[model samples]
Target: MVNGTNTSGFGYDSSTHSVIAEPAVWDSYIQVHKEAGKWRNKIFPHYEDLCIIFGKDRAQGNKAKDFAQMEEDANNEEQSEQIEGGFEEQTTENEDSPNIGSKKRKKVDDVIKGITIAANLL
Candidate 1:
């Protein structure tokens, strides 16, 4: 908390139950939370862990709805990352393949080849 531009001190408002922090300290807190959010996303793969990180109140807050939203956000974020960075590593320019993996591509290619041969014979 800060008082009258003084750099050092903690001030509490009894009514608000919140500390008034210096601008610099407040900014630091914001930055720390942003970084922690990144780590939380990476470390917590499940809804329970996310709730634990967010707080118990969050875990209990309309859990069916809130947890579903969290999972949706996580999935959308992962898919967006994969779309942007080409994490679908096994995918190719070919559109016929349904799966993104070497084995799947091989199977698709064989099917295409057989179809081509049948078309030529006809």
Candidate 2:
């Protein structure tokens, strides 16, 4: 019954032997692990969100896969260009236009496709 720093049965018993924990010490451990479980969820929907936004038909196209690949390729190309040229190049079609953030800028995927089409023309 002693709950202070030390005393009888709780700490030193009548024989002064330190008894270990008893069996069935915790009868309810599961409830502690589930605390705030529902509050923890992904901040952003997986690639599926992008697919829906792009209006892709699940039965026909895998847009999430395509986008992941495209983004990977664009990143690799950028790194290679930076190393070969000492720095990556930036092109602006109009100087007087308003400055926009990076995401607002035209994607390099479109630029690459345009270059591919122009190369076939020549």
**Which candidate tops TM-score?**
1
Candidate 1 TM-score versus the reference:
0.23
lDDT of 1 by residue, 54-111 (tens): 6544445445456457656756775676455453443453454645555654775577
**What residue runs in model 1 are displaced by over 4 Å at the alpha carbon?**
1-65, 87-122
Which residue pairs in candidate 1 have backbone atoms (N, alpha carbon, C) closer than 3 angstroms, thus clashing?
1-20
Query: Worst lDDT window (10 residues) for model 1?
Result: 36-45
Provide the clashing-pair count of each candidate structure: 1, 0
Q: What Cα-based lDDT does every candidate model obtain? A: 0.51, 0.42
| Runs off by more than 4 Å, candidate 2 | 1-52, 56-67, 87-122
Could you tell me every candidate's TM-score relative to the true structure?
Answer: 0.23, 0.21
Q: List the residue pairs that clash in candidate 2.
A: none
